[model samples]
Each structure stands twice: as C-alpha cells, then as structure tokens.
Target: MRIDTRVEINAPASLVREKLLAFSEHADWNPFFTSIELVGCDIRDSDSQVKPGDRLKVSMKDVRSGKVSTFTPTVLSCTAKKFEWRGSLIGQWFFSGIHTFEFLEKDDSQKCVLLHHETFSGIAIPLLRPLLKGTQTNFEAMNNALIEVCENGC
Candidate 1:
C-alpha cells in the first residue's frame, strides 16, 4: 500500500528545502513530526541540521489515536532537490515504509513544487494498516503549513 501527497509553494526551492531540513522547527509548522532529535546533536541548537546517513529520533502523533509514537530512523538520502528515509515496524516482514520528497523548480523560475510521497510494503501492511483513515489529510495539512511559513519568510 502507498499514500502519496504533494503541494506547490510560491517560493524558491532553496528556501523550501531550508525550511524542510530545519528539524528543530518542525513542530512550528508540521504536525506529523512533532519533534525530531538528531542522534549525536542537540536538537535545540540553532544550527542543528540533518544530513544523509544521520540518525534521528522522531516523535509523531497518530491523528486518530492521539497517541505519540517514537522511532529512530536513518537518513537514507538528502540533497538540494530530493530527500528520502525509511522506517520499519517491528521488523521488515511486518511493515516498512519509504518516504520520498522532490523539490522541483517550476517554469516560472521563482516558484517551486514539492512532491512528497510515501510507499509502504510488508506482509502485514494490508492487515495492520488503518482502513478508516488515510495519511493524505495529514500530508496536505503539513504542506499548507509549510507553504504559509515559507511564503511568510520563515
């Protein structure tokens, strides 16, 4: 199973990426990621940032359950145009997901489009995943928040 969502923001890709990589400020505009702490760095530091191969402890709340889940995920890739990461549930056979993001420069040159997508695969995906709710809403909410923040000079 897969759930993908994306949005376009009227801002430069550099600014967008800068905001996205700002782990310390995630909770300011992102609800999905309540908090993210780098493995060996102070999350509250003003200069803290995430890079490829870094490990992160993330706390995310399940909208419906209202319960926060914590996990340590490795940074699969990070670059000016794209970013990716993978996480698992229990083990690979049970449930796993890959989140990918693309920051494309629009034809206008001054605007950018963000393509955020996630793929889920595992033997238990069909059985353990939520059926009543989907991740699309959360993704859109985050996108809107990001757009507002970036456009407002965050």
Candidate 2:
C-alpha cells in the first residue's frame, strides 16, 4: 500500500530540507519519533550531506505500540528536494517499507510531504493488514507535530 501525507511548515524549502535531512535531529520537532538512537552514522566522502548508500540505525517509539522499535535504514537517495530510504526492522521482524520525503514550494510558503510505500509479502498479509493502519495514524500525528514546531519556531 501507498500512503501520501503533506504538511505545511512556515519555513522555506531550504530550511525544511535542512531540518528533514538531519535524521538524528528529529527529536527537535518530530512527535512520533521520541528519539533517534543512532547505532551508526556515516556520511559519504563526497560533498553530499546524506548519500544514497549511507545507513543510520535509529530507535523509534510509537504511541500505538507504546514500545520502541529499532531499525537500520539505508539511505537510498538524498537531494535538496527529496530524501529516500529503504528500511528493515533490525531486531524484530516486520514488513519492509520505503520512506520518501519531498520538499515542495507551495505559493509563499513551503510544504513537506512524506510518502510511505510498503509491500506485504508471503503469508503475512492477513495479520499485517491491521498493523499497517498505524502508519496513517502516525502520519497524522507527525503532521500535527510539524505544524506545532514550525508555528512555535522549534
């Protein structure tokens, strides 16, 4: 399934991109992500801030789960307008998903959208369908957080 979500922030695309690219820096504004416990971080040798091959180990706690889930995401691509990653549940086994963040200029303001596209394979569909609903809920919470942070200048 594909989930698309857009959020408007009272900031320019450049600033939005800056805030989003700093994956470990999410705690500053992200509500869904309680913290990003980086087990590892490696920036590419080139001028790229976050390269396609870079990997980050992060810990995310969801209010729905009420438990922290750790995963290692290998950055697929990163640019001024887009950042993409393919992630796998590091310890606990779950379905794999691709996360893409897009920064767009909307009129006088800027908008950031997160596209979460996931595929369920094998016989897990029957059980995992309900679990995927949480992603949408999480997206709503995240949009709320983004608005609050941008409004409060966090």
Candidate 3:
C-alpha cells in the first residue's frame, strides 16, 4: 500500500526544509509526530543537520484512533531537497515501509512544493489492511499543518 500526498506552501523551500528538519520543534506543528528526538547524540554538541547515521526517537499518534506509537528509525538519506528513511519494525519481513519528504522549489516563486509519501510492502500488509484507516487523511492533515507553520511562522 502507498499513501502519497503533497501540498504547496507559500514560503521558500529553504525555510520549509529548515522547518522540516527541526526535530525538536515538531510537536508544535507536526500532528502525527508528537515527539522527535535525536538518539545517542546531543543536539547542542552534534552537527545541526540531518545525516545518514542519525537515529530518531519518534512518537506518532494515529489521527483516527488517537493511539500513540513509538519507534526509532535511522536516517537513510538526506539532501537539501529530500529526506528519506526506512520504517522501524521488530520483524522486518512482516511489515516494512519507506517514508520520504521532498521540497521542490518553484522556478520563479518562493513557493515550496512539498511531497510526503510512504510505501508499505510486506507480508502483513493484507492482514493489517483493516487497521489502516485514515492513512491518506492523516498525510493531508500533516501537510496542511506544515503549510500553516511555514506561511505564518515556524
């Protein structure tokens, strides 16, 4: 299953990327990720940018069910315009996914075109499909929340 969504924000891509990469401030604007913390490294002492080796302690709340789940996923790749990461699961073959957030700049405008997508392909996908309600809605909510933060103030 794949849930891909995007939204355009009236802000520079640089600013949008900055806001997205700000892990500490996620709770204020990020609806899904209530908590995002760097693991095994202190923000004050570590580099102030996303890197492949970085690990994140994430807390995500289900938009439909109001249930919160926690997981730690390592950074797979990070660039100025894109960031991607594989999902976190104890049983890798049972459930797996990849999440990618992208910022595509408009040629003559400061608008930030953001693409947020996730793909799930695993043995448990069919069995767990019933529990995946509001997945697309959740992405839309997150994207709108991001727009608010970028357009107003992050």
Candidate 4:
C-alpha cells in the first residue's frame, strides 16, 4: 500500500529542498512529523546533515486522533532532489515502510512541486490498512505547512 500527496509551492526547488532536509527546523513547520532528530548525532550541532545509513528518531502525530508515535528510520538516500528513509516494525517481514520526499522544479520557473509518499509492505499491511485512512490528509496538511514556511521566508 502507498500514500502519496503533492503540493505546489511558490518557491524555488532549491529552497524547498533545503527546507525539507533541514531536520532541525522541522518542529517549526511540520505538523505530521512533529520532531525529527538525527540518531547518534549531537542535537546541539545544528549543522549536522543527514546521509545514507544515518538513523533518525522521528515523532509523528496522527492528524485525526492527535496521537503521537515515535520510530527510528534509517536514511536510504539524501540528495538535492530527493530524500528517502526506511522504517520497520519488529522486522521487515512483519511491517516496513519506505518514505520519500521528492522535489520537482517547474519548467523555467521559480515554483516547485513536492511529492511526499510512503510505500508500505509486509504481512501486517492488511491488518493495518484501516489505520492508514487518514494518512493522506495528514500528508496534505504537512505539505501545506511546507508551502507556508518556504513561501513566507523561512
């Protein structure tokens, strides 16, 4: 199963990408992902940049229930145009999700489109399907918040 959401922001792709990767600043704008901390890295070091193999402790809030769940996901890729991570519950065979953020620049324009998605797999998907119903809306809320931050000079 997958949950994908997209939003167009009136900001340069570079700016959007920068803000997206700025994990330290996520709490200021991201509603779904309330907090993201680089694991094994000092939180005080605001300059820390995430790279492949890095692990992150993320706190996510359910938009509908206001419930928060924390998980540690390993960074799969971090690049100028994309960021991806993989998180598993118990084991990969049990449940896992590959989350990605992709930035696409509009043709010859300063605006950009952001694609936020997560691909879920494993045996638990069928049982967990109902819980995922509100995920799309949560992602949309985060995307809109990103637009606010990027366009308002964050």
Candidate 5:
C-alpha cells in the first residue's frame, strides 16, 4: 500500500526542511511519531550531517502498542528536502518497509508530502489491506500537524 498527501506551508523551504530533517524535534511536530530517542547514531564521530548509509537506533511508541518499539533504520536519502529510511520490524515476522518524507519548494514556501509505502507478500495481504485505511488516516493527521506547526511558526 502507498499513501501520499501534501500540505502547503507558509514558511520558507529552508525552515520547513530544517523541521523535517531534524529528528530531534519530532516530538513537537510529528503526530504519529511521539519521539525519536537516539539509542545510537553514526554521526557521533564527526560534524557531518546524517546521510545515506547512516544508521540510527530509534525508539518509538504509540497508542497501538503503548510500549516503545526499537529498531535500526539505514538512512536511504537525506537531501535538502528529501528524507527516506528503510527498516524491518523487530521482534516480529512482519515484512520490511520504507518510509519517506519529501518537501518540495512551492511558490514562496514549500509543499510537504509524506509517503507511506508497505509491501507485503503471501497471506498477510488480506490482513494488511484493511489496515491501510487507518494508516492513511494517521498519515493525514501527521501532515496536518506539520502544516499547523509551519503556519503558526512553531
């Protein structure tokens, strides 16, 4: 399943990119991602910003699990307005997936688009199809929150 939605922000592209690229500020903007606790990050050695091939140990928790889920994701892309990460589900037999966020320059500001794509093979297809609806809802909410933050100067 793939879901994509865009929101126009009043802020300039640089500010929007900064908020999206900074994992440390996720708690204030992202609705689904409660927090990104860095258990380990490859950037510990130098001043270089995170890039493709960089790995991060992220701890995330939500209402569904009510418990933190830990996993390691390899950064796939970290350009000026694009960020993507790929990871597998830990402590489970679920399929591996990719999550991406793209911020495109609009007229005077930016258009932030969130993409959630999940690929499942075998018997899981039937079970996962129905779940995509809820997943889409959450993604929309997250986009709205991001827009609000950008518009309100958060």
Candidate 6:
C-alpha cells in the first residue's frame, strides 16, 4: 500500500529542500515527525546533514489520534531533489515502509511541489490497511506544514 500527498510551496526548490533536510528544525514546523535524531553520528553540533546509510531515530505523531511511534530508519538517499528512508518491523517480510520526500521544481520558477509518500509492504499490510486513510491525512498535514515553513523562511 502507498500513501501519497503533495503540496505546492511558494519557495525555491533549494529553500524547500534546505528546510526539509534540516532535521534539527523539524520541531518548529513539522507536526508529524516531531523529533529526529541522528544515530551513532558525532555530527550533532549543528543541523546534521543526512546522507545515505545514515541511521535516524524519529518520533512520528499521528495527527488525528495523537499517538506517537518511534522508529529507527536507515537513510536510502538524501540529495537536493529527494530524501528517502526505510523502516521495518522485525523484517521486510513482516512489515516495512519506504518513506520518501521528493522536490520538483515548477518550470524553472521559484515555486516547487513537495511529494511526500510512503510505500508499505509485508504480510502485515492487509491488516494495517484500515489505518492508512488516517496516515494519508497525516502526510497532508505534514506537507502543508512544510509549505508554511519553506515559504516563511524556516
């Protein structure tokens, strides 16, 4: 199953990417992933730049239920255009999710579109399908908050 959400931000892709990659500032604008921490990395003095293979311990809050869940995901990619990570429960066959954030420039304009999505697969997916609708709504809220942060110079 996949949950996708997008939002157009009135800011340059560079600015959008910058704020999105700024894990340290997530608490200021992000309502979903309320906390993010780089695991076992000594670069915590400043806003650490996430790179492929980096491990992240993140706390995500469900917008509707207000339930918080923590997970350690391995970063798959972190570039100017995209950021992706994979998190799993037990093993991939049991439960896994690939979360991604893509930044698309709008025809050479300052504006950009942010695509936030998560693809879930595993034997548990069928059982978890009922909660996906709320997850999508949470993604939308996060995208809107990203727009506000990126456009307002976060």
- Estimate the TM-score of every prediction: 0.86, 0.76, 0.91, 0.92, 0.72, 0.93
Decreasing TM-score order of the candidates = 6, 4, 3, 1, 2, 5
lDDT of 4 at 90: 93
Best by lDDT: 4
- Per-residue alpha-carbon lDDT of candidate 3 for residues 26-118, written as tens digits (9 for 90 to 100): 889988888877789655542237688778888888877888998887788889888887774656688877888998998665898999998
- Clash list (residue pairs), candidate 2: none
Alpha carbon lDDT at 132, candidate 1 = 18
For model 6, the superposed segments whose C-alpha errors exceed 4 Å read 44-48
Better of 5 and 6 by lDDT: 6
For candidate 4, report its TM-score.
0.92
Clashing pairs in 3: none
What is the Cα-based TM-score of model 5?
0.72
lDDT of 4 by residue, 54-119 (tens): 899999998789999999999999887888999999998999999999989996659998999999
Candidate 5 C-alpha lDDT tens digits along 67-99: 556678777887776777776644225645577
lDDT of 4 at 51: 82
Candidate 3 lDDT (Cα, whole model)?
0.82
Q: In model 2, where is the ten-residue run with the lowest total lDDT?
A: 113-122
Query: Any runs in candidate 1 off by more than 4 Å, and if so which?
Result: 41-49
